[model samples]
Target: LRRQDLKAARESIQAVLKVAPDFGYAQQLAGAIEYEAGALAQAVTHLTRAQQLMPESLAARQLLAQALLRAGDPAKALATLQPVLDGKAVTPALLNLAAQAWQQQGELAKAEALFKRAAALDPADSRTRVALALNQIARGDASALESLQATAADDKGTVADLALVNERMRRREFDAALQAIAALEKKTPGQALAPLLRARVQMALKQPDKARQSLEQAAQAEPANLQAATALAEFDVRDKQFDAARKRFDALLKADPKNVGALLAVARVRQAAGAPAAEVRTLLEEALRANPTEPRPRLALVEHHLAQKDTPAALTAAQEAVAAIPDNPTLLAELARVQAVAGDFNQSISSLGQVAAQRPDSVQAQLMLAEVQMAAKNFDAAVTALQRARALAPRDFTVAQRLAAAQVAAGRPEQALATARALQKEKETAVPGLVLEGDVEAAQRRGREALAAYRAALAKVPASTAVAVKVHGALLAQEPAAAPAFATKWMSEHPQDAGFLFHLSEVAGARGDHAQAEARLQEALKLRPDDPVMLNNLAYMQVLLKRPGAVATAEKANQLRPQHPYFMDTLAVALGAEKQFDRAIELQKKVVALDPKNPLWKLTLARLYLDAGQRAQARTELSALAALG
Candidate 1:
């Protein structure tokens, strides 16, 4: 008590009690020690026994009650203090303790009454008034705060104004908070707490540049204001600059390694930047160690495990998360998705049902249930589930597409057609719409109508390679007679286009004009000789025409794309005809190797082998061919 080393005093007294076993002086000292040490539970145990031994001691009874109040055992504290409070006025210290405990227990009237009584008992004490003002604000009693502010204004002290301004800041009324801080500064210029409050107000207003200036001033004014530095670090995070934010947080952490806020801020910044998930996991794990009760790190750890596709680790994380946030629908939904992927579908279904009950209109939940139903061959149920999902997300293309597919499978093509048609109509009129009209006509089996759709598509976008090809194919289906003219015109219009040249050559060959076909193919080769499709096209056409020097041309195509099945097959055909049977067999073997299921390659390979007098190899190839399809 003399030295005021509460921890040392408690340890020494406890040591004495341990040795002596019945030392009243040591026990009394322990009570005194723990009350000052703020270990209220330990202090209450020591003080209760000490009060029994020293029965008429007012100091022991007061200390015991205050310790009980600090420990949040307010009923016990109230009983201890009732004798002192009833039929008697209380001291400032005893009232402060009783009010603190009552406030913690949510008994605002009793707390505020004690605070008022304490301030009246010590009218000259600014500290008691500051405590009373804080309690008033806590109770939302604005009148008490007004009384305190007037009392502080009447009093001549910077500390009271500083404390009053801080109370305004705690209320998060930044404008009013700023006015209070300005008042404090006007009263006593360049005070530390006012500048700190001004920085906090600037940060709340999202004026980072101003906040930084204010924080710099606060940190300079009171070098111990660690909160200003922490706030500045968060400002960099608000600006989405992680490297700068990380630097600031790391600098703070370097000076005080146990700063949990700095550590947590760094982790949050990394998470926002999509840093490789392992880094995020490491950060959360470290933060969790500092604050085991915090839900954020545990939840983030679950998300990280999911991202890495470690299902078992994810499950453990999710279980911890659900325990922390038992009613969170998002947590339950994510957990169910993990369970489903790991083949625990029953658990997944139960979890999803809970989420569905909580959020019946959730399109994602309904869609997931429908997909699971479809996988389990419950097609009718899947269709019903999808209908609900579609209603929730009426404009969702995926829901519409899947719903149509399910209808078609359930022998409802007309319904499928109707849904597709409705979607097509919406796209045609909707602003910022995306319509593929060809899909609509194709679904209805109207190839000719699809041709018209593609033609219209071309009118809107003439340079679209895919649309031109689509329209050209549709036009050739039943109007081969019109194709040659269209092909000629198209080739003339786009002279450098190899696809148009290929189409033109096909049209010429169909008309039995071999010379014209050859001229077009030559022109295509001149433009892009080594282009894979062009090379394959030329080689195949040469083989079809039985043209002289076909082997040389096919050889060149093969050299450019050795493993291409079409070029390899063409070279095989060319080689076999030239009586280079062994070379032809090798090329044919490669084609079969590339596409084992393509029996055409096996048949060709066998023929080449037979011509090479390799009957065993030929028979093997023939057997492979016989096994296919």
Candidate 2:
């Protein structure tokens, strides 16, 4: 069974059990076979019977405990191991099993102690050392690499070699990892482990084609290897073969019904394919039911709710996940993300602070805190957190970019410009730095310098739509008469870009050429027929032109994004244009309710009431807007 001949092993065990039904050893063997076959419940039944028949059999008890843990019942596993733990038998195997149970229960300190004890008792046990090394790695100890290297050198087996590959990857030593994986393949020819490790290393090196080929080879070499199959399914997802990924995950689930990875993978694929929300929800809920203690499905549920824009539901799911794994920094970080998205910025900051406090050296945690602070417009706090992150990851470009942006937001444009220029000098491609320079110069009203910066960026990356938009906007702001000719030339070059057409419409509007504005918006609409923003803009232009069907076009935009305040405001304007005064007033009221602090919604509401011939309501709304001022 350990050699993967499960059918033959099961048949032999069954034959022995049939001849001697009460034989404890045969029953234990049968139970082990079932466990290896992924029938956890049946394994538990047989193991329990074997324990009852031979109450003093330590091996039977150990197997039962392992089966319980695999069944996602850590509490039951601890209970099954109680006798061995209390009797002080002190076997390295028993300590290792107990350590796993404690780890599953989130008792990391106890687990670490037990793992150390086991490693001390069996000094040459590679598996025990590997487990201890993993714990150390989780705590950010670089010495874990030494332990992992020692284990790999001693064992030359799958677990230790995989650990070495992962450690190398974590350290960003992709070339070294690849070399190690190649040697592993030579040592274990035709084995799936080496190919899978090679695929991961190739992925880290950004060699997608090589990674895909290695994944396929691994899957072919071991048809029953779930890790290989999962990797292939994930690769299919990346390739946009959603149906193929779903099929693979479905097969995995059918073979092992309680496979959490398969469940999550299928849900992810469905979500990516834009499957119905209810269908994705059902899949995630089923996974939660199957493995209630697993944090992955719960976190997925939180993300799903957030994507659907159900903030309260997302918060509730995040809370549940945090409750399940209270000490996990990753889960706590996820809770912070949900809180931030739900507009609970203070609470989000508090949660993130906890994670940073727990893992002071974690760059990811510090970066997350900085991001939330920036979103909250607490620029000074963001700067402080980002400086910490920059100290930790000095060469990380993203950290540098965000720090520069935060410095600009904090009213230190000179410092931001210096940082951006330094980044431009450091990198071979300096388009992003040039863009940042343009943004800073534009903020400082240095129009000519900003234009020069933008042009430089466009020269480097001519096809960059964002750079084109920035250049066009800067030209229009500085030299309005010259803007039209620049827009015309750019539009002629990028005729298929609806976004550029929209920018042209804005430029036309600023120049008070309503006809040209309407024409450009119409052209954009033709290219992006189903885009709600395009629909809203076209409808608004039609309303301004007093053209017919404006209401219908705005209604389509509203239907596409029912909760969007801007779309609703456009629909209200269209209603007023069509002389549906009462409907328009009601829609404005809803918009005001959505964003009460917006003086624009209040002013719009007042105008709608006056047009509806409701003097009292108009006076009240105008008074409110005046109070806001």
Candidate 3:
């Protein structure tokens, strides 16, 4: 077994078990083999039998406890170890196992105490010290770095070095982590682990190309390295190379038929590529079946249902996951998110409150609570939650941005502007802050100030589609003549930008140049032929220009966005231009029905009826429009 001849060891263990079915040592050996083979549930069953057969054997009890923990039943692991613990016969191994079980159960204080006890019992043991350092790191103690570094230095090429790298990652000390990885690579040249660690650190540092190269190097160096291959596949998915990722994951599945990570990765890639939801769900379900104790597949299933807008299914999945891991903050947070999306705001808040109580320092939980409150239109409550989150993570730009947005939603534009200005002072390129400032200025009816703010943002982030659109819209609203030159200059610089071309078209239409508007719209459509808004605009301009096939273009736009009233209205106008008054009236009436309160739709409907010579319907619609005044 120590030599990793798993097949021979399993056969020998079975023979021993067959000869002495009641022998505790044979049963324990069988259980250990199953555990090493990743058959955690079978390991638990065999180890339980061994423990029951030899209730006084501490080794059997320890093995059973370890198997139970691996099977995701940490409570059962603690129960299994209670006799030894209660009898005061605790070894360092037993203490470590108990600490791990407690940690899995979310009893961090008890876990840390047990870890400290284990380290004190064996002060020279690097593994126990590494465990204690990991516990301190989890609690955000920077002092853990000293201990972790010492362990890594003393225990080269061991798991301690991996823990040191992980601790550095948790602290976001990417450069230091990379240095340690470099040292480890130098120490153990040609090994895949160092390259794999480098890839992970590179990814965390947002150097995706470097990370990809590193992952490729690791996979090439060790063709059997499942971790490196899986990371490479995930990177492909992130890069939207779905076909390549799927092929690689399929090869992995062929190598290990029940590879749950490969199944989950393939499902995620398929989901991102907009594959059929049922197909993605089947893959996730298969992964779940392969590893019932794993939470990732279950989480993916919930996310899949949520993405499909099957909120009820999502809620059910989330509830089941929370039930399975009641103390897990991540699963609880997922349940809260599902509840919020399902419109059960009260339940979502209750769940979030529980998570906040359990994990008081979790900014994610507080942020989720804020999101739920914002969705409920309780903007003031959202502000409070966001304030808490900001207090917890004061340096997080996202929390600050969300807080400003929430303040704006709560009708505190001045406060929002103040926050945005403060953020702008802190950031070197404050495009988001400038955008928010523009929004607040626009909301206050300061058109000139809003335009200036938007222009400033555009200057900082010239390639930002959103900022460019805001700048163009603000310019058009405040200074129509300047809008054309601004848009034309931007278009010259960004010839292939369909949005800039669309903006130019809008400017042309505003200046009553139907020919120029139609030309610009056609150019924009060439760049983004499937954009329904561009098609609708082009169709509308074609009708105004009295062009041939205007009706066909309008119909195509309407087909692309069947539920859009504006698209329907454009189609009606094209039909009316072609002397199809009855069909035009029908389409106009559908538009009016969609937005009964819109005076524009009512007026259009009245004109359509008048054109159709329906005096009674036309008079009724005219009276309704008059009443709207």
Per-residue C-alpha lDDT of model 3 across residues 253-303, encoded as one tens digit per residue: 664555555677678678655566678889898998886766778888998
Off by over 4 Å in 3: 1-258, 266-279, 427-431, 455-470, 488-629
Computed on alpha carbons, the lDDT of every model, listed in order, comes to 0.67, 0.79, 0.78
- Steric clash pairs (candidate 2): none
Q: Candidate 2's residue-wise lDDT over 1-629, tens digit each?
A: 88989999988888888889899888898899988786665687689789979988999999998776555455557767766764656576777778766754446566656656666666567777777887788789988878777777778654556456655665678887887677667777755657766786787687988988997887666444455666677777656688998787554466567667668778877865656678998999999888777677887888878766678888998898888879878789999999998788999999999999988888899889999999999999998998899889866668778888899899988888886687688565388888878888888899989999999999998987889999989987898788778887888898888988888788788778877888998899888887898888888888888889999999888766555789999999999988899899888887776666568888888888888889899999888777765
lDDT of 1 by residue, 1-629 (tens): 68887767767787788897566556667877866654444566678777767756667777787655433345556656655664355676667566655643445466656666666677678766776776676778988778667866777754455445545555566787677778777765543445655776776687768878887776555332245555665666556566876775554455445444456667767865546556878987897676554455666677667655677988988777777778777778778877777778778778878888887878988888777666656678778988999899877777877887677666666676566566655643221111244545556577776677677767766765556666677777746677667666776777788777777677678878777778788898888766666666666666667777778887777655544677789888888888888788877876775565567888888888888788998899788767764
Q: Compute the lDDT for candidate 1.
A: 0.67
Q: Per-candidate RMSD vs. true structure?
A: 21.3, 12.6, 11.9
The superposed Cα distance between candidate 2 and the true structure at residue 110, in angstroms, equals 35
Q: Return the TM-score for candidate 1, rounded to 2 decimals.
A: 0.36
Alpha-carbon TM-score of each model against the true structure: 0.36, 0.52, 0.52
Model 2 compared with the native: what TM-score? Answer: 0.52
Off by over 4 Å in 2: 1-6, 10-289, 300-316, 338-347, 357-364, 375-378, 391-398, 508-515, 525-536, 543-629
Stretches > 4 Å off in candidate 1: 1-436, 478-481, 503-520, 555-562, 613-616, 627-629
Candidate order by decreasing lDDT? 2, 3, 1
